[model samples]
Target chain A: MQIETGELINITDKGNNLFHLIIKADKIADKALPGQFIQVYCSEGESYDPLLPRPFSLFRIEKEKGCLELVFRVVGRGTSWLSKRHTGSSLKLLGPLGRGFTDPREFSRVLIFAGGIGMPPLFSVAEVSKEVDFTLFYGARSQGELIFLERWQQMTDQIFLATDDGSAGQQGNIVELASSLLDSGSADFYYACGPRPMLKAVKRLMAKLKIPGELSLEERMACGVGACLGCVCRTTSGYARVCTEGPVFAAEEVVFNE
Target chain B: MNDPRLIVKVGQFSLKNPVLTASGTFGFAREYNRLFPVSALGGIAAKGLTVQPRAGNPPPRLVETPSGLINAIGLQNPGLTAFLQQELPFLRELGTAVIVNIAGFTIDEFAHLASVLDGETGITALEVNISCPNVKKGGMAFGIHPEAAARVTRTVREATSLPVWVKLSPNVTAITEIAQAVEEAGADAITLINTLPGMAIDIKNRRPVLGNISGGLSGPAVKPVALHHLWQVYKAVKIPIVGMGGISTPEDALEFIMAGATAVAVGTAMFHDPYTPLKIINGLSGYLDVEQVGRVEDLIGIAHKKDGLD
Candidate 1:
């Protein structure tokens, strides 16, 4: 993990308040991996209004061009400030921090679940392990929120989608869709990233099916490194820092709070 | 001339500079060492240690407020035995002064911690943390009251031969009363102020944001409160003061020194920028050169002095 100033090379409006940012940061891109994240300083120099840096998963790592991609939505002040930045500006990033997902190539059959902004890290997993067979179950609020659909379709034919309003593939939720599909199908391993409810439901499904998997977690972080112990998630062992021990953990190891 | 001297003395020991990373913020100096050489700083107070391992509070441990962060880490540490066996050796070799911050449930626990660390090499001093606001039993429970605060300070003072710096809490009625009480009890220096008790609510959930319900507030938000308390305590106590709370930049550190602090500690700002302490050290050097000051020691409590204005 190093602090690198990455120049904003490009910005794409993925629509529905979601943005795709590409930064030219050689060192950070060189070190980044799937499921790892970078802490972006929202404000310009010497400003502490939004005092803490916001953590973002490495949506895409283009090492050859020394570029890193971030996918974020304008949810609050920090992301709002991030959205207003123009191309050619610079962002201070501290990354590629935290333990990432298990190498996708290690598993013969892989299942991926992504919800809303949670798609980035899992998308990274699919991008890195192209040779591995993957079944993606993606859910969003509606059709507009289902970002990068063409990209996922290009990657695999086994893509399944769900939207809350039934404006997309399946109605209700992605967890139920994935659960029903898995009744006749089997995967060696699974990976999930999304809202806590989705993750919890996936965890339950994985437990019921007796399939081992990993879940990427999120929390409000202070020190992106483990120094502060601010972003910890309860685990079977005890509390583990999401900044270090995870942003990803074995599904079974996590004890989700009710 | 050569670079302006950044060195300053706190109690009996001399620090290489007037900048120290606040306890709980810097960890054991191991984490920040990955970003920069921690030895460049004046000193480091390791995270608060207890007699036994603490799991701390549950998740949602932190919440970002306006220009501040509220955290209820609850002093989760690797316990005393692990510190001696695993952490201290690494700290001893950091080539910087290591001030171990200890928290305890009772006065005896405080004494026990001090006694165990008494002859430990490479430790510059013992920062008795009676100011932590997260824990239910010992932390600020002893800190809010003068007699209790003085009792903890006196017990630790007797247990160890090292310099004792009592870290004070801002969530008190009269901070000076506790400061003076600790001074009278044999505290060599005072570290004020710990995070001010504060909370945030999740409006959607209609619940408190932090898992601990309420946590101590730190960062730029508490700067004024910390400075006010430090200014008051500086007048009440003769011992040196290690001023902290929302200290991030060289200007902030200079403000603390001018307000009567011998040294200043960078706390919540380190979360925003890990290189903050190093930046402050260089900034201090640059400030001294620009002002034509000889040493950082020359500026201590300068604001409190009655000059031509008086």
Candidate 2:
């Protein structure tokens, strides 16, 4: 992991609280792995109230010039400040931090579950494997919140889209849709990200089907370097840091909830 | 000599400077070693440890407030065995004093941890973490009462020969009483001002932000509260003090020293800048030279007495 100032290339609004930031950070882009994220300092200098860098998963890693792209939602003061920056602004990024997904070639069949903000790293995985038989299960509240569809369509044809209010594709939650798919032939491997409830549903779905996979967790973090115990996730084997030991873990190992 | 006066002594242990990374803030020295040299710090307090492995709290463990953040990590650490097996060797090699911060629910648990690490070759001191507010059982319960705090301190003090530093909570009504109790209980030093109890709620979802419902607040927001506690405790006890809470810069640290803290601990600021401890250490060096202080100890307790400048 490296900490360096990343030059902002552009910021584009994708709709429904989502924004895409493209930065030219050579060292981080070169080593970024799937499921790893960067702690981006949102404010310039030290005049900000929330004095912590917001964690964002790697959406796109362009290895040629060491440039990377991150997509996030403006939920609070940190992200709200981040959305106002223009090209030529520089911010410090500490990454590519945390454990990420392993090689896809190890598994026979891959099923990807991405919930809203979880789409970025799953997108990175799709970009990595050109020949793997993978199906992307993407979910969001509305079509406006579903980002990078055209880009995903270019990667694979087996993309399943679901929305909460029947606003985009299938009705009900994405995990329920993935649960129904498990009623048929099941994939040997699964990868999941998004909110905890969805991950819990997936944990149940994985247990019912006896499938093993990896999960990328999201947590509010400080010292993206894992020095702070702020981003811990509950596991059967003590607490694991989402910033260090994970952001990615054995889907079966992490205890979702009671 | 162009050297800056930076050595700070406490009990039998002497530090390179008075800038140690506080407990729960500096995770066992390995992670931050990648960003900067861990050898640059005066001391490194490992994460709060428990006898049994702790899974900590559930999702939404942290939230940002005005110039601060609330965290209820629930004392997540690999049990002592794994820490002894995995983390200790690395910490021992960090080229700085290694202080282990231990948390327990009972007096026996506290003594058990102290006894276990008592003669460990690398550990320089034992910082009893009786101030954690996140857990329901043994955390802040002991710190809130002077009697309970003294019992915990006495138990650990008897179990270990190493220097003992008792971390105090600011949520108490009178911190000086607890400080004096620990001092009389054989505590070698004290670390003032753990996170203040804090909570936040989401109006849209009608739910509390932290899964634990409430957490300890740290960062710049709690600096005043920390200084107040340090000031009060300084007048009550003769033991050395390590002042902390929302401390970010050299100026903030200097205030603690002048207010009667022999050393200062840096916590929440490390989240934004992993280089904060080193930055403060360098800044202190420059400050000592510019202020023309003969040594770092020369500035201690200046605010409590008459000074050269008004």
Candidate 3:
């Protein structure tokens, strides 16, 4: 993938310090599938304080408009810098990278487990695929942290949400909700992206239930490509690059904490 | 000539320009070719290889600081045979000088690597990694002792007909002594300084961030230290230096060059910006032309003379 410069087309404040950035870049958006991410250089070429580009999964791709949207919360130097980028600012993107979600048998009964910032890529997947009707489990620490609640409500009939505090939906966690949902054995295959603990829990629960699924993982990456080898995740085979080998892997392949 | 020349000579190797990606940062030179053809670079120092495949350290292999990143990857690689079989073929197609960076646990392993790769075609030189701070064994242990460092250099030097580039560690008290020892041991060139010893703590978890506890710190945070060490080693030894540590921009590369580096390597910067080497390379070309210098070699040791040092 070429590192192309895209002009910031629009920036929408999605409230709760979450933002939806629309950049008019064809190279990444044209090839970008759901779950693949772009490494964004938050500033002009000279800045090194936040020395690495932050990886943002594809939130939405407007193919007709030739623009892709990235959703992120203002958490640190990189995101804060990205937040201030105006419509005319130049943004560099290195992507359409990593393996995107595979349909895997057209997954008629799909279960998506998304937590906090993990909702975007799943959102993109739900937006594109009409092949398999799916249920979405959107969760966050609180209602304020939920990025696109209205959209999730509109997307599918089966949207299960959980918040840590009793601000919204069930007052537990997403992995627990996923486990309870899996107990019924409704989902044919599942997809997930979230905090590691939640994913580990999901993996364990899936293993216990003898279910098969794919997970979209997040790691602190330097190069969005495999060149850096900085972002690594343990697997049954060996170490795999979270950037190149996957931001998506079979749930069975990953070896979580004991 | 009105236009400046960017070619630089390091031992028997003649780099089209003086921009080599530091070992361990650029994996086998294939990954970055997807973003940009690495042919524009002067050279590629392929990832640090061992005698056998290493799985590397556990997860939490990396941490980010203010202007640096500490990675305790533990010299993970597919080993020498795997690299020769799987990696070297594609590396040869890149059409740039490929310098293999080899890490060994013993002087004999080091010599064996050099001896084996010596017969291998398409390798410009070998960067003997005696100063990897991330691994628990055979890494920085050889680098801290000048005698041990010289032993590795001498052993590898005897084994290989190809030029040997000894990579030195910054963790030692006196890097100059080690540089001198390697030079006397028949090293053709030197790459300084490898990452400095560092660690980060997760106060919330009440433990070290990296699985290995500590790793070598690289990036702009280590540039000043790298620059200082480069200057010290430059004054101590007569061999050409492939200076690198935290180099991100053309100006940073120029700093290393002015400090007496024959050429500069871009390491951690590659992590941040994959095309940083190209940026620095183009920037150097622009710099030399703007300054009306005929040769990049003129830029070397300029800072030393500016301080009125002999």
What value of lDDT does candidate 2 attain over all alpha carbons?
0.87
Error of 1 at A2 (Å): 0.6
- Candidate numbers sorted by lDDT from highest down: 1, 2, 3
Give each prediction's DockQ, rounded to 2 decimals. 0.86, 0.65, 0.73
Highest-lDDT candidate? 1
On the 0 to 100 scale, the lDDT of residue B293 in model 1 is 84
Better candidate number, 1 or 3, judged by lDDT = 1
Tens-digit per-residue lDDT, B178-222, candidate 1: 999999999999999999888999999999999899999999999
For model 3 chain A, where is the 10-residue window of minimal lDDT?
A: A178-187
Better of 1 and 2 by DockQ: 1
Between candidates 1 and 2, the one scoring higher on TM-score is 1
**All candidates: CA RMSD in angstroms?**
1.5, 2.5, 2.2
lDDT of 1 by residue, A70-154 (tens): 8998888899899989999989999999999999999888999999989999888899879999899999999999898889999
Q: Model 1 residue A115 lDDT?
A: 94
CA displacement after TM-score superposition, residue A233 of candidate 3 (Å): 0.7
lDDT of 3 by residue, A1-258 (tens): 778899899998988889998899987788888888888987565678888789899889877777889999897789999999888998988888999888544767778889898788888888876566788888899998887788877877788889999699899898787776666477778888888888888788777877688888887778778876778998999999999889999999987877
Worst 10 residues of 1 chain A by lDDT: A178-187
Q: How well is candidate 2 docked (DockQ)?
A: 0.65
lDDT of 2 by residue, B77-139 (tens): 888999999999999999988989999899999999999999688999999999999998999
